[model samples]
Target: MPRMIFVNLPVADLPRSMAFYDALGFVNEPKFTDETAAAMQWSDTIVVMLLTHAKWHQFTDRPITSDGSSSLRLCLSLDTRDEVTEMNRLAGEHGGTADIDPPTEYPFMMSHAFADPDGHIWEPMWMDQAAMEAGPPAQTDA
Candidate 1:
């Protein structure tokens, strides 16, 4: 089986978070969803599990971190910089908050950061591996 990523995040309100992600067009995997958590499928193999704070703790014995004032950020990449902007915008429109700073621009990458309603920081970015390898933006001959 192909390696899969399961990003487990803690949410204050299960239903509200579900609605927020739903607006962004992520389908819920009912087989993996329940009252305490929901399995959000963003792609065929990438899965994110949104769990209530309590449920999150149940999955582990370690203390759960309250996102109220944390400075940590998690980055989720996308195919294009435009998609980053769109996702960050939609997040804000649907109860999430965009990062105070504007999207960052570099030679081969662009990123827009934001926080969920509960203040968990997330960055949606676009990075071209080939372009990055070339260093800086390539000069096209067109």
Candidate 2:
């Protein structure tokens, strides 16, 4: 069986967070959703579990961190630079913040970063493995 990942995050508002993730192309698994939590599927093997603060505390004794104060940032890869741009646009359109940083273009990859409504940072990126293995391109004047 293939390994899978389920990233669990604490959200202030389950519905609002669900809406925000939906805009970013995740489909909610209704069977796993309720007032206390939502399971958003990013791919066949990847899901993000959004839990209410109270529900989250039931699993961990650590204090809840406020939005924008989180230590971990989630990153997802896309097939093309265009997809990264589109995801960032959707995030902003659905009440999230885009332009966490200007889009970056290295010889091998391109990326855009944004924040969800709860201020959890996400980076959507595209990469060319061939270019990456070849190493960074020689510097040139802008």
Candidate 3:
């Protein structure tokens, strides 16, 4: 079987978080969802586990980050730059926030980011396959 990744996030409101993910094109996997936790499937291999604060603490003693503080950001890849833009737009329209940074475009890729209602960052990016095959772009002085 192919190895799958499950990125777990702690959310203050389960239902609201579920809805926000749904808007960003993730499907709810009801088989693993309940009042306190939800399994949002972004792809066949990527599933995000959204757990309420209390439920999350059951698994770890570490405290959840407060609003406006971020430890890490999650990224999702799309097929095209337009898809990246559209997803970010939808995220904002569906109770999330966008424009965390200006969209970036390189010779090989394009990307944008948004934050869910709970402040978890999601970046959607698109890369050119041919450019990838050519190898990483040359490093330049800052």
Candidate 4:
């Protein structure tokens, strides 16, 4: 089978989380959504599962931590820099806040971070293909 990744994140509320992700242009997969879990599919290999705190805790023994007052960050890349800024603006309009100060203009790459409804950070990044080709091979965990 092809490789796949399912990122499970704890959310305080399902509906609000759904709305937040919707604003980010992520389509929710109803087939995998329920009262406790909302599946946000970015692509074939990228599946982000937004699960309620209680539901998430059921899968792990560790206590679930509230996102409030926490500065942890989560990063996700995009295809273009315009998409990054657009998502950031859309996120802010839909109750998400920019995690970073402002847009960073670079010759090769661009990035901007945003925090979701529950203060969970999300970074949208873009790296120029030409610049990447000029550099070393990208690193991967596997």
Highest lDDT: which candidate? 3
Per-candidate count of clashing residue pairs (backbone under 3 Å): 0, 0, 0, 0
State candidate 3's TM-score.
Answer: 0.95
Candidate 1, run of 10 with poorest lDDT = 63-72
Tens digits of per-residue lDDT, candidate 1, 1-142, equal 9888888888889999999888766789999999999998888878878999889888788866674676578777798888988999999999998765688998588998888777778788899989867777656999
Q: What is the lDDT of residue 59 in candidate 2?
A: 100
In order of appearance, the predictions have TM-scores of 0.83, 0.88, 0.95, 0.85
Better of 1 and 3 by lDDT: 3
Query: How do these models rank on lDDT, best leading?
Result: 3, 2, 1, 4
TM for candidate 2 is 0.88
In candidate 3, the residue pairs with backbone N, CA or C atoms under 3 Å apart (3 or more residues apart, or in different chains) clash, namely none
Q: List the residue pairs that clash in candidate 2.
A: none
What is the C-alpha local distance difference test score of each model?
0.84, 0.90, 0.91, 0.82
Angstrom error of the Cα, residue 11, model 2: value is 0.6
Better of 2 and 4 by lDDT: 2
Top model number, TM-score? 3
The C-alpha local distance difference test score for the whole of candidate 1 amounts to 0.84
TM-score of model 4 (CA atoms): 0.85
Error of 4 at 20 (Å): 1.1
For model 1, the stretches where C-alpha displacement exceeds 4 angstroms are: 133-142
Off by over 4 Å in 3: 140-142
